[model samples]
Target: MSSILSGTPIVYFECRQCKCVLQNPTPDVLDEWKKEHQGHTVTETRKYPLFDLGYNDLKKAGELAQIANELGAVIADIRFMPHTRNPEFSLKHLQEVLGDKYIHVGELGNANYKGTGGIQLANTEAGMRILHGLLANSAVIIICACWKRSECHRVYVAKEYEKRYNVDSTPITRTSARDLLSSVEEKNNPQLALW
Candidate 1:
């Protein structure tokens, strides 16, 4: 049918809150969030450390992260496709779980997961608040879309944080989750994805 042929690519949006992608988020809602807040700053994008992992499959998480960490990854994107199952886990929860163990990895940019989230965050005061909290805790977000680009970009958070607070940020890269779990004695297990 002509309708099917004319459809735009459906980019999934992972809720920074739930960790699950907001599938096909409506543009009206996206626009509303952007309009609610004004005078927000956007930043240049830097390449994030990425790995190829299928996000839809929760089953292989252990296997993927375990092996990847064993190999030399500090963070793992074990999933590429954001599914409903990923749940809406906020960046705050992640900070609690990872604590200091969560080494900075991934790109330094904004959340581009939904492909609309970045635009949304620019508008929503609530979104900005959450981002500020994550930055306060020194959260290093990692979102992999296709292994080459970040589905969820948040480098802006890092750089903006630096500029606002007059702090210097050291971003890290990650090939897999294995790098995070490995110790100094582990062979081939790279540490501090950054220099």
Candidate 2:
């Protein structure tokens, strides 16, 4: 039997006859490999992207857009009350800034956001279904106002998505997002750094 393992930092290709290794194989590459290999089975090990971002981390909607663009993901605002003191993080502003890439999944949000009540599954199943539909096309980055994942309802939502979808989720921190953004900027504007 032959198989192609993907959806991780690295992708691996193994066959009963021989082993071929490729790093970060794109969709085109995977397609070409399949055509050439013929009869080989393909198994994707890569989990869908389930990111948790706090507005406190990246204050600007443009910054959030950059991160989402880089990940090729839709921004899922998982806050029951999407309004925030910061105008940039407000629901209206986010919808404007993100345009088509933004969505408010209030169903996944915690109804008792102010109190001690935990995740309400009543609407969660519906919300998860919505997210499931989205995941079929692109990755999703769940966002909230809380600075820490442990201190936010997004943690529970992330867990639910992982369990329901049978895929691992990555948490995007401020530092990590900044680093990726920096790399992207450098790639785009190499001449700017020369000065």
Candidate 3:
């Protein structure tokens, strides 16, 4: 094992096709790290993962569900396109697949069906109130119609959430599963998965 591992960045595991990173660091290690840090524990914790199924193949959904389960994620939003008028289809697809294993959200953020923007957060006071309610309710929102994370408006929205709501509305961009979990750990208020 040393011969193969020597002078290497200890890739505990990896996929043959996708370069998505993976690791098996134990829960005890996370607990110890938490003990060392003086960070505040997240009470109203949520994953708030933003995803785009358009670029992703259907085969990845199960893997996504399993990963969320492993990470103690409570929600897996399957938000739909608002402009198309058939928003329920999004929920139907996820329901046929992931089912009730995680919480589902529709009409995430302010996404227009044209496959752009975060859910168009309400601009008015009533809209802000609604946005706040959505944030308080959701864990992971995967209804974006685009590929690149930069194109998605949720990133900026999450930043604002960090400033205003004091909740982690940010999206976790990890090359692998381990990196994702670590990102969660390093947050101002890390989410403790309820799985």
Which candidate leads the pack in lDDT?
2
Better of 1 and 3 by lDDT: 3
Candidate 3 lDDT tens digits, 34-86: 45443543221332332223323223455455445444443434334323233
RMSD of each: 19.3, 6.6, 14.5
TM-scores for all predictions = 0.31, 0.76, 0.43
lDDT by residue (tens digit), candidate 1, 1-195 = 111111122334333433333345479865664454334432222222222332232233443344333333333221223233344322333344434433323223223445643522333344434444443332323333332233433344444545654545443333223233343224344553333
Error of 1 at 120 (Å): 5.6
lDDT tens digits, residues 1-195, model 2? 012111123345544333564445778987787777778654543335567788788868998998888778889898998887899999999999999999999998888876766656338878999988777677788898888878888888888888876767777777777776775587789985565
The stretch of ten residues in a row with the least summed lDDT in candidate 3 is 1-10
| Candidate achieving higher lDDT, 1 or 2 | 2
- At residue 91, what lDDT does model 1 achieve? 34
Q: Is candidate 1 or candidate 2 better by TM-score?
A: 2
Order of all candidates by TM-score, from best down to worst? 2, 3, 1
RMSD of 1: 19.3
Taken over the whole model, the C-alpha lDDT of each candidate is 0.35, 0.76, 0.41
What clash pairs does model 3 have? 21-175, 21-176, 48-139, 109-119, 110-118, 110-119, 110-120, 111-118, 111-119
Over 4 Å off, model 1: 1-124, 135-146, 149-152, 175-178, 184-195
TM for candidate 3 is: 0.43
